[model samples]
Target chain A: MSVLLTPDQTAFLQGTLSMNVGAVGRDGWPCVCRAQGLVVARDRRSLTVLLSASRGRAVLESLDAGSAITLVASRPATHATLQLKAARAARVGVSAAHHAASARCVAAFGAELETLGYAAGLSATLAGVLPTDDLVALRFAPDIVFDQTPGPDAGRVLAHT
Target chain B: MNISLESLRPCLDGAIPAVVATASPDGTPNVAYASQVHYVDSEHVALSFQFFSKTRENVLAHPYAQVQVIEPKSFRHFRLKVHYLRTETSGPLFEYMKAQLAGIAARSGMAKVFALRGADVYRVLDIENVDPRLLPAPAPPDALLKLRRTFAHLGACDDLTRLADRALAALAHGFGIRHALLALLDETGGALYTLASLGYSASGVGAEVALGEGLIGVAAREAIPVRINYHTGDYTYHAALYVADPASPRIPLPVLADPHSQIAVPLTHGEYLVGVLYAESEENAFFSHADEDALVVYGRHLAALIVQLAALPDDAEPALAAPAPAPSGAPLAVRYFAHDHSVFVDNDYLIKGVAGSILWTLLNEHAASGRRDFCNRELRRDPRLPLPDFGDNLETRLILLARRLAERCPQIALEKTGRGRFRLELARPLQLNAG
Candidate 1:
């Protein structure tokens, strides 16, 4: 079943997945690279990450091998981090929910998003104008989600999701 | 010069005013004016006059006497007292009295008449009881207030080295010492390191002394101030480290050369002796009782500062928790980087080395917390020979090291990353294992 996330959940997923995605590396070793972009599925049950193939291929290979991995996603200013543990499934295409999540990230980070080439590259990739081979999507189905949020309201939002 | 009555009457046929005071059996004090008294020594006063004086009778009965000689114009007072032993009408005192009377008569233009009469002198013998109230009231609160200010100043200081220097300077200035040095106790409290010094050549500092070695050591061991006359034969345990010129003929070289006064005050935090403050002067009586009191006050404040400084935790080191175990069924890769020579174990150990071992030893010895940056800097500047590489061959070496570590510690998951970094992920949170 595809789960539709509310705006708060969408924001939460973007933050958590962003942190966790950076932790993933080839052969369980973190490599020197940056987070490209985070795209959440319309149902919010899945998140699509666009990263450098060169930098991310090793981590994807580790995930494909069924190695248990932990991704730490967090919002920098707020001490909110989500540790999502799961093996990677097959590659999937960007969905409407993914584009909406991307737009929200762009709006939240604004000019800062350009520094990571996330907003520009993600937009190009989704328009069908950019080549898809340049990007590889790992559909993360969270097995265990650990949410560290500051207050009761944030905890409820994470718990409900 | 207001001479006592006994001296005045014998010298000039002039009577001098004197006041005799005595404490009665019931503790009540009695004072009487006497027209006859004389100076026996700088410390003693004698009276020779008619026995009808109440003070004379009091002194005769009680045998305890206090006499004051007052220079009415200058307001200067000389006080003395003696307990009576016996009375004598003739002796050198009598001859001295005769000379004084003739002089008095000559000064008064009655020399012929006074010379014909001769001089009468009565000597009081034995001095059993004499009370001299030379010390003023002890202003304990005033001393305490100065001590409090000193402590507050020291407490506001954040730097240990600077604080120690300031304290030594204050001590030296307050006590008027020609030279002062403060030596901090080493880890075992068996030795001392000179932390600060004043009024000495550069060669006179950075000296170390063992326990029971010098005045400093004695003060530390006894936990009290040690006052010595360096020139006296009594103090032979002077530390060579403190001597500016050992071959010089004088031992303490006499304060500046006076060799008569020296003091070593132990800086203590509670029962622990942190260091000693040594002060010396060239004068025989440089350190009066007042100076000793001042030093004690200063020493107490210094001790408090040393204690407070010792209590402050070192924040330079990074807090390194033990490596956590990797998740279940995860492949472990470990790598050793030779450039930095740091061991990067899988997600677990960030950095470890012989430098770390040395730092650990120092921290433990000093009872200090290990700081990451400080440890790193120490390693970078380490004067000792470099440690051997973890393995001859990086790849095979790491694999063996990992298997060995795994066998010894079953809980920790050690994995080798293809990159220089290794991951040691925890199967469970680190806090659970803490129990």
Candidate 2:
């Protein structure tokens, strides 16, 4: 059974917030970096996130290992978080339409950071700017979704609706 | 420049979640976030193993790991190369981490979840300062220097009062702590009474909190330190956590509105619990890991002073002296709320509990024998007032009663004439009513 993203989860993914991805490669060294160029597929069956070519080397290697990984998208204002446990990942080219969404995502996430008590310019700084070259999108099918909000429901496995 | 793991402690306190990376035996690398990287020693740190299956598997199988931690106050980051050690399910470190996790969990509304499976202790192999900004270091409350200075000044205190004042002054100057309170453990073995407090509207001079009650109680009960940082969370919910928690004390313990940070350190000498040192602030994350470390060291100095002073002989003359004649006035009515032992003088609220009973008892004795002077020994032995088992808060109760009387009920007052002895100065005759 494939779990579809709930309306709330869909809203979270589309909202302005920095996304982080975690993975362990075949060699077993774990790595994580700020993920940009986030896109939730229209059907909510999968997610596509882009890692910069220049800064996401370890992250790309982890994805290349094809090991299970976690994608966490969180709003800084309320610490509300959602974790996606993805089983498979593949690299894809960035589309022009999706490229514009990436800029909008950073701007929105920056607004959330400001609401969370960050200084005026910190949001822009904390949001990792997408690199121009080798900006690869990771298309992964989420096996399970976990509510990663900073509370009891955090990490709770959500049923596929 | 290289750094010892301990020097990077402030960064590891878990305020800012740390990211950990580990490689499998086959050289496959993994990365995940950790809630806290607890400092075990200069050579080790304990990472919480809750449910990160991959990270756990990698560490157990490979032994090599790296964690990147950021200092919350100053956003400096440090990377620690560590090797996996044994996992501890139970012990001092585990329990301490459990308490800390509880605070963090409770603050984040995850107290019901985030179970502590084990404390995975890791031996630090190397530490690297990720950024070597050549800037003047931020002042850290000068913990080491202030601790040394506090110890020297504490050594000069000849009495408990002086010792307490010096302790508060030391924390203020050394730790940059703005608000602090020192409460001596009552003889009842179950309550702590306010003796000295700074940074409150009222000194909360005579306020009392039972053992195992609130933050103060938890620290005293476990003989451990409890610290928390919250942007917004009502501490009042603590009572709901405990079924039989007494209704919020009428005289509320001094605390800031929306207290962003709080800490309570238990003071003990050998097996005897001396008192508790509590500090709070309106600023978020006001106290850091280094502050906790500094205070724990200075707490030893306080424990020694408290024990030494308690063992020292009383220097004041015995009480039983007839007080100056009572000035004439309308008979003021003293009402005692037996339910909570709250006392009100002529409808004006005064002290309560053992403190209230003590005042009522003193006035009772005055009406009967015309004697105004009383001593700690007499109050401790008084049968009319119910002091809890081993309740040695007499001297402090007298201090509370005297201060309350002096503040609210000016007509009838109690003043300390010497150590353990005080004279009741009655400006108006009083009628005691038992409620």
Candidate 3:
């Protein structure tokens, strides 16, 4: 069975949400890195998120072909969280489309933080957005998704791809 | 592994929440936001396990997790590799985190949503700074030097009143803490009364807070330190319990309109809780873990000194003051209520409980005879006043009575003449009544 993200979930992933990527290394140790932006594919089953090359070096080193990967997208002010897990992932070079999407996402994230009472330029700096040349994208097809909101229904599965 | 958790203490302030990464036994990775990455020690940390999420499940299965914390001031990030130890459902650390989370929840208007279930203790396996570009952190004030000076000042005090004043003064001068108060617990009344304070327009010396009412009360009741780094109305003592009525005898607790940081540390002598020491700031996150530690040590020192000074033997003979002629004025009405032993001066609410009872007794003794001096032995043996048998804080009560009189009814005073004796000083004639 193939799990597809609902329209609302896809919109949420592509919206001005803070993203973080998690990957497990060969030693079974997991690493985390902040994501600048993400772009959902048309199929709604796969997505690619831009990670800063220097900041996300730990997670990038942990990434391997067919290794497990997880990305959590959260709306900061609301604490609305969604987690997507895939059994496989691959690190790829930044594309022109990824670069443009990264800029748009970072700007939108900064605006969202501004509305949440963060000082100007502080929100953007906290997001850790980097030049597109220093960003790497990880593409994966999420097979498991969880509504990770901070309440009783947090771990409930929304879909299983 | 090259990094130490001590240097990364700022990152655990919860000013910026941490993101936790965990991997299941089956190799599936999980990531989520942990609201608090509590720094337990140099090799340990704790996370609030409020919800049964994927991260919790993965940790239970695999035991290994990675946490990334950001220092709000510098925007610097650090990654900590930790191994899951055991979850503590109740303890000092759990209470500390629960108190902190309550403030966070209240600020976000999610008080009902977030509840701390357990403190998941973790052993730090390694720590690494993810960012190479770092801002130079400002050198913190010398906490050890401050504590040393504070103790030195407290060591010179010989009485509870002097001890309380010196303690507050030490906090102001040494720790740079401007807003602070020292309150002693009235065990029989299940309340705490403010004896001394600093940095407020009003001294609020006689203000009382019921047990479990606010940070100070809760700290005394639970015998644990309670600290909130942000302003939260949910725990505001004045709003929580104090409702001043014109007819009632009450002193409103001193409050900051909008305090961003507040902490209350329980002052205990061994197992007995003696009182609470509290401090606040208008600036957010002003009190850190090190400050809390210093305050705890300072509170214990102050409590021990108070007990030691209170136990000193009295002078061999009671020194009596020569009866001075009373001033020519209208008789001041002194009313005492038996229900709560509350005293009112000229129909104005003055004080209540043991202090009030002591005042009533002193006034009666003065009216019956021209006696001006009293001894602790007579008060301790007095059957009319309610005092504990084992650890009767009579000396402290006299001190409280003296301070309350100084604040409310300046015409009446209680002056310590010796270790166990005190003289009742009056500037005007008094008419005593029992209501």
Candidate 4:
């Protein structure tokens, strides 16, 4: 059975700083980056990320060339991670996913980082210092998920229900 | 101005009830009166009639049908030469037709007409063509008019990256190009540096072309738009130009492989050619004179944006200063994208997930009504069920979801507006830096 994340778990997975996304290139090399504003599908079975075409296009092209991809997201600071091995399902318009991810991100961190300086920093890093027209939304269907949290109790938490 | 169904009803007032006409296997004309002539969405109309009609039977046999709807009194007509695909009998469309039939019956004092609903079917209408004379006369050039009125709006954009993106968006949206590239001329106007490109790889951006090198360079050097046909052209100078791969099978290199169309519009401010907006398509003669005119207009607007950005003080904030908040209680414009799982505030603050949808619908309703508040009166009411809420745990879950989104995107604010209403607002418009 697939590991189902509760609302709290989902939130933790999203806000956790250590969750990394690994993508495989056509040459079989894996490129790993921090998963920004990763969102779970409404059905709780899929996760999506808004990837700039500049960076994510390579992975998409690789997938189009029939290369399988694995995305591992983890909160290293808390020693909690959700690693999902999946293939690219589709690429949609950035506007479609950005709005959702932005809203969720705002709600998730809006109160804690209300300062203008923080907003500027967030915008600079997350929205990119420059805007490109081909920024796209990548939807991935996870074939397998691996979760690891620290401590003896972490094992139970990572255990499939 | 708000366009309502009432206003649209007048357009169809004189339109005749369409008749589906098809040829039988024996070449006999089979015709059936179609009552399914109603607005589908805001722009298109849907027509539904009985599937078992002679015309439907003939259409199934032939896959081709001509539908005619004439002005009731004038006999002036509209015809649609359509190829029938399939029939959808259930779902939202069926319910929509049911409600429409009910309204029609009520208005015509024939409520019994809806009683035979199942037998009275609906046919999907696809408009193939419209009589040219039926269309209204060409409107005056509103581009220049809008530019005059909204020059300040363009002037307000302070970021070069955004200006570039917007310029390309205008080109793609207006000209229907699969991809676009904006390469700014270096300070000396000698070489072109790819500042940003749509539908091309990252490696393509920042690439350079010397003055008088390729199409873009020629356009920049001459300060004129360069139109090229790649298939038969002497590509000795255009071999290294970057072309978007996903758009077509043709490669950007080896420009002489197959016949392709390309247009390069130099971005100019008065006399200075600041950049080149290049667009291409694999098909022959992809662009027209009218398209070139639009691109020139767009190029002018983009030049204006660049000049304004260049004129801004170096120390000034990168985004437009917020015009004082619209009173504390002013409603905000919001758009909800449930299928895509996102919400936009004033079409700017794009937030992800169901929380965005909730906030979007609430704010949109309140804004449209000039009201200050709304509640969860219709939660998860969409039949498509794109959102998943765990019943009473909605608030808590949403709060968590909001926090997750905030971690990456901190500019958006979701706050309680009143007792039951929530407002999602952008702290500032997104700023895109060119460097």
The best candidate in terms of TM-score: 3
TM-score of chain A of each: 0.55, 0.88, 0.90, 0.63
Tens digit per residue, CA lDDT, model 1, B37-110: 54454334445443333334455556665444433112123344345655556544433333333333332233
Best by DockQ: 3
DockQ metric, candidate 2 = 0.22
Off by over 4 Å in 1: A1-161, B1-155, B229-237, B241-258, B316-435
| Candidates 2 and 4 compared by TM-score, better number | 2
Return the TM-score for each candidate structure.
0.31, 0.74, 0.89, 0.27
Fnat scores for every prediction: 0.00, 0.27, 0.80, 0.00
> Per-prediction DockQ scores?
0.00, 0.22, 0.66, 0.01
Model 3: what is its DockQ? 0.66
Chain A TM-score from candidate 4? 0.63
True contacts kept of 4: 0.00
lDDT of 3 at B180: 88
Candidate 3 lDDT tens digits, B16-95: 77899999888888899887888898999999989887788999999999999887655677899999999999867887
TM-score order of candidates, best first?
Answer: 3, 2, 1, 4
Q: Give the alpha carbon lDDT tens digit for every residue of A12-78 in model 2.
A: 8888765767666565555566666678888988888876655556668867767666677776555
- Candidate 4 at B167: error in angstroms? 1.7
**For model 1, what is the alpha-carbon lDDT of residue B340?**
31
Instruction: In angstroms, give how far residue A121 of model 2 lies from its true place.
Output: 3.7
lDDT of 2 at A14: 85
